[model samples]
Target: ELLLTTYAFCYHFQSDDPLIKLVEDYKWIDFFDFHWRLGIDGLSLGPILLTGLITTLATLVAWPVTRDSRLFHFFMLAMYSGQIGSFSSRDLLLFFIIWEYQWNLIIHT
Candidate 1:
């Protein structure tokens, strides 16, 4: 799934352009007047791709491990999701939330 998604993103990615905004909504936040925003650019693309590739490879490599495998994969995928979220997030609060979520997943995993 990740590989295919990454491939699609790469196919559509344009390095010379600024970030592409995927979402923007002020209605989701009522306090501090912040909007929920998400975007991706060349600056963030590297980390996003790296995170996806590494997580996918790690999952493949760890496939033979049978000790609490489900839990391990769950946390791993959760961490990856948080990382992707952080990379794409255009809002400070959302980035921080994802950062903390990734940290917590790391601790629990």
Candidate 2:
């Protein structure tokens, strides 16, 4: 929902902007992407929004899943922590750490 809505909004907003149209209409820039019709339409804002929302809701939902409240909480917290790290990471190193953390939880769980 967020992705599609943001993409639609951005595309429509830039549809009338001269600068956006200039880049889209350029020959050289358009040549390499000739076969590829899709391009960044300034809708990257959607992912930014969706990532945050997913991270937040996932954390909230996972909290109640672990009721043993001792060792079980560790995996829940660990999983949530990894999810947050995954969402915030632009760097490969941190993302890998988070990815591994989740797998670690799955194995232990």
Candidate 3:
């Protein structure tokens, strides 16, 4: 994403020709198909953020009750990594992998 942002800015600032207009024409929405547009939206971003926050807060709240707070910390960290992975995943299979990554955390907790 950093590289992409850098490249985008490079094109926007360094080029002024009309032909350059064609290079950065794609919208973020274009990444998804028409069918996906029905399901994915700004509204969905809110819930994903909310759910991620809830999981993080729950883990923090459970710190004292967990038998070994150290182990809980490890598993919670794993979960946090997974949630971030899922948040950024564009491929369905990659998203599934991210979702599954939290299973062990569930079992351990």
TM-score of decoy 2: 0.39
> Taking the tens digit of each residue's C-alpha lDDT, what string does model 2 give over 33-87?
4221122233433454565466556656667765576666565456555654464
What is the C-alpha lDDT profile of model 1 across 9-50, one tens digit per residue?
767767777758344545456777767777787788789878
What is the TM-score of candidate 1?
A: 0.83
Off by over 4 Å in 2: 1-67
Off by over 4 Å in 3: 1-44, 104-109
lDDT of each: 0.79, 0.50, 0.51
Per-residue lDDT of 1-109 in model 3, one digit per residue for the tens? 2244335345543343322221212133455532111122233344545556676678768867757778767766677667655654555655676678777667766
Clashes found in each candidate (C-alpha, N, C closer than 3 A) = 0, 0, 0
After superposing candidate 1, which stretches have Cα over 4 Å from the reference? 21-26
Worst 10 residues of 3 by lDDT: 34-43
Best by lDDT: 1
Angstrom error of the Cα, residue 16, model 3: value is: 25
